[model samples]
Target chain A: MASQEIETLAQALARLPGFGPRSARRAVLHLMKRREAAMLPLLRALEAVNERLSTCDMCGNVDTSNPCTVCADPRRDVRALCVVEEVSDLWALDRSRLFPGKFHVLGGRLSALEGVRPEDLSIDKLLRRVEAGGIDEVVLAMNATLEGQTTAHYIAERLERFPVRLTQLAHGLPVGGELDYLDEGTLAQALRARRPVS
Target chain B: MASQEIETLAQALARLPGFGPRSARRAVLHLMKRREAAMLPLLRALEAVNERLSTCDMCGNVDTSNPCTVCADPRRDVRALCVVEEVSDLWALDRSRLFPGKFHVLGGRLSALEGVRPEDLSIDKLLRRVEAGGIDEVVLAMNATLEGQTTAHYIAERLERFPVRLTQLAHGLPVGGELDYLDEGTLAQALRARRPVS
Candidate 1:
């Protein structure tokens, strides 16, 4: 018979994004088998993250510090700000190490179907950051989805009055993308944005 | 920038049986977003399970109690014991509520490729439980895999001198399984084990 505590643990794991009931059951069994080698270390790591978890006051990024690592890093380009829809997006971009700038996580994109509006997000906080000045450019690095574009457009309109230069991520065929496999919209965008041979 | 604590949490999650690096990152971000609603409860549950986790001295099953819920249940049939390769198999069988008997977890199947011997499993403990007397029958409900069958055969031979009756699960088409989709071995086994229409 499954104990109440083990069932409770499985239920909690099932609530996570990717895990379903079967996978949660398997994971719990796996953890129970390797208590010292796996479960204890994971428990300790989770406790540490939970205890120190904090949000960046200026940029809405979740981290263990008030200003977050990116915001507090003096070596990062203060003049360039990358605005993203969520902390996951921030992480994905930061992982590439291509952008040497601070990030502002908007929490989520504006979704009309989901009843999300400007006030629901950290848009005002983003505006306030720009208003405080010294940022030379604001890159709207939102996703290419309908809601993402809508949110980016809304933010661009709001930042129109500011002195900072506004830009968005360019749309094009992805690296190693086969022309036959690419969608029509992507093909059109790639053709329109085609540059002279380098 | 990803904090050390967050990275550590992701790495821990990645080490789980089904999780990869990408899914681990997504899970961490999801947990961070709903820290109070999700992460804290999971942490508490893990801690609770970890604090009380114990191996059943009787059946080699894992539970918060030494005897395990199944072993301690007086309503269960003491004369019949279902033998399985792992705790997961025990849980799966018990979940069906079809087995009124107790269980004997073998810990793992004997495998020549992996160098697993009979001594590596809880076969001795199981034999001792039967030798102590009371069991009228032993059901070898091992998996259909080669190693599982090999282990079952070995155990059956060892228990040949005992007073108890020996039995095994039937090989047949799974409930709702299509005949055309079945493997040749499974079809052959099903044909070989065909019973009366009644």
Candidate 2:
């Protein structure tokens, strides 16, 4: 249906998290059509990132710099550290502008089925960061999955002996989540953690 | 939320047909994680295509070769040409292997809303191809939209003097379309084109 180069590009694109074969094909066609406006820019950006990409030595966040933007920023609160499962989680949290602190990426959570044990993650690095002593609070902002909770709990136990306070994200109905469509666990959590009217 | 290079990559990816900001971010992260497996291959493919890309002078098809793969294939029925609105349409038609003939891409259809005129397309070139000789049939394989039909009609009018047979794709229910879910226009077309049972 197309050239080998176009097919290869589509195959690589289809491997992305949200894209399929049809969408990848569409994307390839679009890129081919808009070579100057889209294709060249994307190629240049990818090459630049690939050439300069590095992980933060302090946290596990990926950036062109060794310390990452968040870790190197003096304006960010060094006393408050947020722990997350991956770099994407860190980005999601940072996008909110609510957490004015640095982040620690665990690389991945403990998953028995996937054989991702505690040793597989950057737990020792996280412990080392806490032990280095200036952080006041450690927020475990893991997902609401069972594995996420298990990882949070394990991290909490390790940080208990440290002077810094350990906290996890509050579980309840998400903003704009319809009560009728929500699951029983979410409803129960929302009810148990009900807030008083001001 | 990310560095300039990663953000630029995400923005460029988001401009793709099916991708949005969120999906683009996820794709960027995926690319970053599997740089060797995914990102480098995509970059290399893009570079190779960019450097070697050419349009067929005869058929307007895009390929590394000037004649393109379809136009260069000696086995294809050159006497029977399939005219389509875009390169993507040509690819779609060829993917089915139902059209053994060559293809001519119009670049786009006549669209009053978008200000696309007949002159803006490859219609003149199409007429030249038909005028230059031994073509027996020209299949008008435009989309089912109003603009598509209008463009097809305009082309048919221009080709009325030519000795070649001009044909079009049939309008009916799609292969897997359900009768209950089908629109009135399709149902009417299907009924009007009803065939005798074997």
Predicted model with the maximum TM-score: 2
- What do the candidate models score in CA lDDT, each in turn? 0.93, 0.91
Candidates, DockQ: 0.80, 0.76
Q: What is the lDDT of residue A42 in candidate 1?
A: 94
TM-score of each: 0.94, 0.96
Model 2's DockQ score: 0.76
TM-score of chain B of each: 0.95, 0.95
Residue range B130-197, candidate 2, lDDT tens digits: 99988999999999999999999999999999999999999999999999999999999999999999
Clashes of each: 0, 0
